[model samples]
Target chain A: MGKIRTRLGDGSFIELLEEEIYEDLVDGTQDAAQKGRIPPLSEDELRYLLDLYKSKARVVGVDEGHECCLSYDNMTSKIERAHISVSKFQQLQLFERALGADTLELAHIDYSYKQVKHVVIYDKPNMEQAVLLTIPPMLYGAMPNLGLYTYPDGPCPNPGDLLPQGKFDEAKEAYAQAIELAIKDMIFVGSELYEAGADGINFDTTGAAGDAEFYAALKAAETLKAKYPKMGIEMGMAGEFILGMHGEIEYEGVRLAGLYPHDQVKLAQKAGVTIFGPVVNTGTNESLPWNLARSVTFTKACSEASEIPLHANLGMGVGGVPLNIMPPLDALSRASKAHVELCRLDGL
Target chain B: MHAAHSIASGMGGMRTTGDLVARLQLNKGMRIEQAKQYVADKLKVPVTDLADSVTMGEMREDLNIGVVNEAPGVAKGIDAKFRIAELLDLDINCVDMFKDRVKP
Candidate 1:
């Protein structure tokens, strides 16, 4: 049987089409030619390709069914997965212990200039030090029964809901409590909270007066500060924010802002936010123009411009370095180490 | 002068009582009075049983009986003694008597 041929986004070719699948591709070739390509894949061919990628394209040995995936690559191992069910409190304890037990000192919890020493509790007597703890905003999203109210509608439940309401209030409360505990332990540094996407889920503010969502987020932040007077908040903005802010939109509510890091810094400062970052690891294979260096540069520039701290959510595994790679502990460690160094260099 | 000299020896470089109190908190069930006595006995003077103060003279004389001028060491010893006392359901002061007799 002839093998099936597939092309990846990187332009790399793979032979997955077998002779048995030749009949399925009979019409695929004509479709591809029509589209200015070799041949179009039939629905069956597409499904097969997706299945193959699902099996082979993922990080090897990391089970998706589990709450977390521990994977390894050429440089280091990492842990990544989604839909974790652990409580924020439990996750925080595990994270603290893991950082200490890993014994990698390159990572740190950044709160302005202070590098707080994380306590290692994982192995107890044989504890190791962790260089970094990659906590997702999912923790905040997972609190019990917290719903978010969206405009144009009412309140939405679950994270997938477009317009959410009550969850914001709950998120505020959780963050406030977390900040209080964190400050007492001197572990409060920065945070990675989920931001609403541009999709119609919440508000289409991405194109219109998107500042509305920012304003809402500000209210949430105000609530948090009222509880933890000493806590610092760092909001993680989606990459779409960058793309949306630069492009022209017709909505009166939505304003087009420059893409320069300084502009983001200014926007964050005006919002009374201390830290701002964008998504880095979205499973996209292509490396950005400057890779993570661009993010670092942008964050540093933004910080300097607005005198606000900035963090870069560098995607997992870029080039050979584990910038945003996951599931592999070693990779996570190295990436975290690199981030610490970058933060230090930027005087964060 | 002899009594003062003896007391001074007993009190040799004793740590502040507040420090001892802090150390006691680390031990699960140790009371402030017990912590004070532990410090006094280590100093080798008559255990005044005071919660607030353990005179330096008394601690200096007690230093001769293996009570080095180390706060951490003393604190550790106190912790261990407290743990054992808790485990055995024995009085903390009685543990000291057992230690003295058992050493030959």
Candidate 2:
């Protein structure tokens, strides 16, 4: 009988049971994949496609989001701590006291990074951070496992209470600050650690577009790109504005995810985002669905609108499903390959 | 850079073996012993702990978590359309669909 309270995209909060979240997330994903007429990736397929993806894709990467790094204490000594004001220091203290990054920093990958020639992205706590940063931290003390990132389950922590709608504007401002902090934190990792090893980044995962968070992510990616030209950036979002039969409508298909908003696609282009990934969302929240058709449509629409590479993904960048959790697929069944192929096709 | 096959907390040796096999299958010519050593050294455990000594099939059967094959053994109406209309990119009432059914 575990209970949790979290915020919705519509700026509301709901109390839900752990089993309910699992049923909706884990079970729902399996059921939706079945309904979408997609088969789970077999082990052999996963293996072969992973091979293909590694050899053929422009970029192959792994996400350790700052929490998962095994070598944190050492890395901490290595990282250049940013100068902090007393106020910001207090905020950091609050977060540090509750749900600090200490437990998650694995400290195992030091040699592996040296041995494996690949890209790695750490979090400025990343999206999980964004969720927390969206509201003033003082208002929301980390209640154990509110939403994502808490682990043994997810990255979510109890988001605490929603700030008044009057505070939504303040939340927006906080979003920009969150993006700034992520960039500032990464500057310490520098190109040699992250950029030299990695390609793009999981900029942010905001379910909707045209919000302060999405706009801030775009601005942040643009800011980082100016510093690291070779760095690619990817964002997670959903929508496809369906007006009527006059627009790009299916004759009789049921692709329920939101159509890509025109302005948001423009934002991606402006952000110089290397790719765009979908967060596997099918529950009746303000999120997208786990439908491949929707993925295809999103790629087509975003590519046409933005004229940039659009790579489809199973979940929000990191903490989202399928991306963070496994899809109903065997290890060898290359969900990564599907994304690479989608990027290739979308590029065309 | 894929973490798909990375060993996780509380995973058993059999599950670890499946990831190792998946890694080998993904990268041709990669040696299993080297991978086992890599994992073992990182986790500070012995190579035997990763189940490299066992068969993947045995690992597959013993795995506690779900996999592609472990997916719900049900399908949509067998005769249902396999793919959505490729061009159905119009803006629709996204939220309403969730009320009827959620699928992200």
Cα lDDT computed for each candidate against the true fold: 0.29, 0.31
User: Model 2, residue A106: displacement in angstroms?
Assistant: 13
lDDT string for model 2 (A22-48, tens) is: 333333234433434433333443343
Q: Determine which window of 10 residues in candidate 2 chain B has minimal summed lDDT.
A: B77-86
List candidate 1 segments past 4 Å from native: A1-90, A101-211, A222-228, A240-260, A278-285, A288-290, A315-348, B1-104
DockQ top scorer = 2
Against the hidden reference, what TM-scores do the models get? 0.33, 0.33
Considering the true interface contacts (CA pairs under 8 Å between chains A and B), give the fraction that model 2 also has. Answer: 0.00
Q: DockQ, per-model, please?
A: 0.01, 0.02
For B3-95, candidate 2 gives per-residue lDDT tens digits of 231221112222233332212211111223343455445445565444432343233333322111223542111000111001111111111
Task: Give the interface RMSD values of the models in order.
Answer: 26.9, 19.2
RMSD after Cα superposition, model 1: 23.0
